[model samples]
Target chain A: MNLGLDRNTIYPATHMWRRFSYFFFAIFFCFAIAANLLAQDWIKSGTGLGVERIRIAVPEFKAANQDPRNSELLRTFNDTLWNDLTNAGIFEMVSKSFYPLGQIGAPSDVKFDTWGQTPVNAAMLVFGNLGASGNNVVVQGWLEDVKNPNSPPVLAKQYTDNATTQQARVIAHKFADEIIFRLGGGINGIAETQIYYVSTRSGHKEIWAMDYDGANQHPVTTLGTISLSPHVSPDGSRLAFSSFNGSAWEIRMFSFDLNRMVSFPRYGRTNLSPSWAPDGTRLAFSSSRSGTPEIYAVDQSGGNLHRLTNSGTTNVSPTWNRKTGSEIAWVSRHGDLPKIFTMSADGTNVQQLTDQGYAVSPSWSPNGQFLVFSWMRHYGPGAPGSQDIYLMDVTNKQWVQLTHDGGRNDFPCWSPDNRHIVFQSNRSGSLQIWSMLADGSNQKQLTTSGTNSEPDWSWK
Target chain B: MKQSQSRWIALVFALGAILFLGACHKKAAPAPPPPPPPPPTPTATLTANPETIDKGQSTTLTWQTSNATDISIEGVGAVQPNGTQQVTPTESTTYTLTAKGAGGTQTATARVTVNAPPPPPPPPPPSLTEEQLFAQNVKDVYFDYDKSDVRADQQSLVQADAAFLQQHPNMSVTIEGHCDERGSTEYNLALGDNRASAVKNALVAAGVPADRVKTVSFGKEKPFCTESNEACWQQNRRGHFVLNK
Candidate 1:
């Protein structure tokens, strides 16, 4: 055969080359379509589910001791943690009755697959020893996440408490927050905060401080006078409270560490609700200094004074938005019923945030997006005292009732992350500090020893 | 010369071929030139009767013309006390009246000064003498603790009360006494009574008639709400006077 081909043969070869190019183009087009489909699948798998609903199994916490009394106390802890976690809304709880997994302990020995058998995405096993250590009951708890039977479970947390059996609910709240953090986001565990409130101990009503779960309780003022509306300073080192000693109801400052108390100047005949500024250098409180209870901001050293409200109404319980330092929410009696009002820090552009029945004691969320306050509905005469905790979204001015069917729930203090709220309630037969999820669920009592009320959450 | 001619012919043919190709290509359709951008309609600059007009007044307006053959003025109102106005102009007027133009519209307003009607006349002054004035102004006298007898510390406050009673002979004064938040409520009530009686005795001793000084006891029921301190408590435990003409 001749090595060089003729023109007719060349023409046939060019036609074949054109056909091969078309075939390659078709292949490329199919590949492009396939690659796009694959890319979409990958993106969907990565970010399609914004947040997975975490199903948590809280096996009824077992007490190290088999004593009936200790078992009862553990039952309270179990109930409180269950309620708190449910209220948090971050967990889809598996009922202990249907836990399916046979008694998992917190030593990381639990089979993960056994827990995964149930609809539970994760399992929280609280195993701890509880007893009296000196004057307090020490509870050592360890939590574990049992998701897979084969893999080693993660040791979630260990908690130690010096509270009495009645105050064990607080320790349980601390453990609940730990489980929440292990799942994903950061939260304010009950162990890390405190509450400043007024209690009728020492034969008189005086300002007192206690752990968020109501464990370590002590009096802040010993003036033998009546103190009302005690507030924690933003730095969490001091407390500002209103006391009626001999002059007017003066706002007094007390150092938590030093245990020393000092009085602010008597600006009005009555002063109440001393709320600290976000910067911790000033206090926003309600004072009758201008002849009515209007909101006023004064420096920690009692220097620069600025009136934050001019409605001449009884504006009480002034709380500053933690994120936005320019706005404050307070209870104003400008209408028939006391409504929640928000105003600029400079006493301008006043706007009403709530038209609900008589709202009081507003506490701000850490993000400054919502405010938790006590809502009171007047019944037939005699100081209508049925109050419940309500959360109001500041941006949209919509309120979510957080406590329902509880007998007199009030004074809600938000956790630093806004996930949980600690409030006071008489639902447990006595007034005590209670912790619940911000969404009105899992109502767990925190205090049991004395009549504890007005629980203010500490900022860590 | 033949080669040169061939070169010129190639150059001309190549140029002609490029021109023909350019003409044949898709011409990019000129992107439709964005529809000529719909000639920017001029905004109407409204000129009111006065730059700063008072409440309840009207102003005259005017303006320039461009493409608009007819124009009208609308939305005219007065600025509120907080410096905001709501206007609703019906038809276009002129500089002396109100008018509109092609460049949009303009307004000029005649000063329609709306002075807030004069405040209601001040209420008639109270008809009281110096003595009555003293008694009315001196509302009460706050006292100290434990001692029913008037203390020297409360001498100045008692003197003010006595002076008022001396001036207003026609006015009868009722001394209402109160106690601090401490102690039993019943005990405080009696103590308040004693304190008011002591104040009445002091006024009598200072030349006011005993019949002129009546005493009442609010006791611990009423507190002046002093600071929760020793000094504030001392100020709260006292007697107050209510004068009736």
Candidate 2:
């Protein structure tokens, strides 16, 4: 048989070797190229899952006053808003060079195409008139969504009564929430909320109320007596607190609008930790009038006194879970650690929800699925001084640590949406109101004055 | 030549046969001894007594195990016999003993009773001292923040403190002013000082001599009760007298 160089014929050994080498080389080259493409595809698909990269353009804030240079208040407000939005994890803010519009409230109209050419998906225009109003500085501005310039921008107004140039940063935080609510799909604006806390600037414990961002702080009671446990009504209209009237601890009510005060029945004993019921018609408080510290419910008119707890183990801090209209949360000393216990408003079906350390001061979320409380672990002496805030899921019985580094953080109050909690801490070297996301991120200090504590966020 | 070629082919075939057999035998042979019996099976033994212990008291248990084994126990009286073992008892403690070497375990515990302790001796019958029985009852007196000057509203509380001081001329007392846990340590300290001074001044004005009373401000350092509410704060923000005979 003769083998020749025909169309599909095998040739001599030398030619066969050359052909085999070329075929092998082609196959190897294809495999290498395919592997590279496969790797690129996997990376793209992996990163494409809900991971969005967005750039933001924050214009320099223009002050309402015709000051030649930028005011420190304006600068602080601008910086705070920038930090809040960046920490919200929704935007990657672009540099100032990208936004040549100069300042936020600058007179020049925003050029949409200018922001569009850059990678910025949204441009925040925060231009406000900051001027003194009575004892406060009012900031009024509108946030425009440059992505869709034709759409109407949202209006945001913040008032910082008793504000110094430094406190303007807190007002800016309120404004930032407004912006987040409008654009970032969070909750309702927190600007109108109030915080009730105990202040001793007057040399005695006085119940004080301030805006959620620590503005417009004012004393609720002027009796010059000892006042503590200032609990805001569910609607944020009235404050139910305990005050010593030179005799015994009495539960008192202070109307925020009328500024009038009324004391509950002079029950020759100490009444403390008044928590307003969801219906706002009754208050649940711990009282020793029953011979021992027990939980009792009093009407808004201080009538119909009903005792809910008879366990006699110093059940204090009774907070009603508005979400579960029938459940009440409190701290029970019946256990070794003051653990969190939940019971029916009628005082049945008691369930212990936590077993981790000494937990106290339980504040339930509006949704009734979780409780935020202070967990303490005393290290050296006296009373186990180390304390931090922890969040527990009532349904799953899971706890997540909210503050780790804040020194002795306690008194955690949840925002209406349960997304953010306002707590008190000496982390910044002084007792101050600080806020963080529910999952323990974006922690920012809200107050800087002498010593502020026991901050209770308003439901409104 | 054809015959010689055939011979050479046979020889080559034989050599190939031998080599293939050798390769097959190598592949099928048993592996070398499996690394020296894998260090011996470390023994760990755990043992305890009474397996159950009562609450509030310490229970000791001994354990012996190989390979430096650690022991642990569980249940109401659950405790670590030593620092190495754990003890937890309130009511009905269960303990588990665990050790190494075949994963051995032996548990013994004593019953733990979480009953309340015996009551203390009763106090003497209530008796009023002659001074307390005859002391004038002053009702009220008030003062400003960090100021000892008597205010108009607190006439009743101050009157009582002063009346008590006046009636007991021979008895000395210490007045302590306290502030709530709300402000700076220094501020509260100063405020407490002012409160005590103000109360003393009021007592002196109400006809009581200043020598009978001493004043000190705890500031916010010491709170009668630690709570964030207004009631606890009210309790902390007051002046108390420690009367001495």
The local distance difference test score of model 1 is 0.60
Q: What is the lDDT of residue A246 in candidate 2?
A: 57
DockQ category of candidate 2: incorrect
Question: Which DockQ-derived CAPRI band holds candidate 1?
Answer: incorrect
**lDDT (Cα, tens digit) per residue for candidate 1, span A1-460:** 2211123322234543333233222211112222321222111111111133355666665555545566666777777777666655555566666656355444554555666564544544444455544445556655554543343444445555654555778777777777555543343444446777767767676777776555578877787866666778778888888767554557888886886976567674556678877888888887655444578898898878878777654457788888767888887764434678888888788898766455667889876767888876453236544677876667666554566665777778887656568887877777677887555555677667667766777776
Off by over 4 Å in 1: A1-53, A57-89, A92-108, A119-145, A148-176, A262-268, A335-337, A355-357, A376-387, A403-409, A424-435, A444-452, B1-245
* A266: Cα error in model 1, Å: 4.4
TM-score of chain B of each: 0.44, 0.41
Candidate 2 off by > 4 Å: A1-55, A61-98, A101-108, A117-142, A149-178, A377-385, A428-430, B1-245
In candidate 1, how many Å is residue A402 off? 3.8
Worst-scoring 10-residue span by lDDT in model 2 chain A: A41-50
* Per-model TM values vs. the true structure: 0.52, 0.54
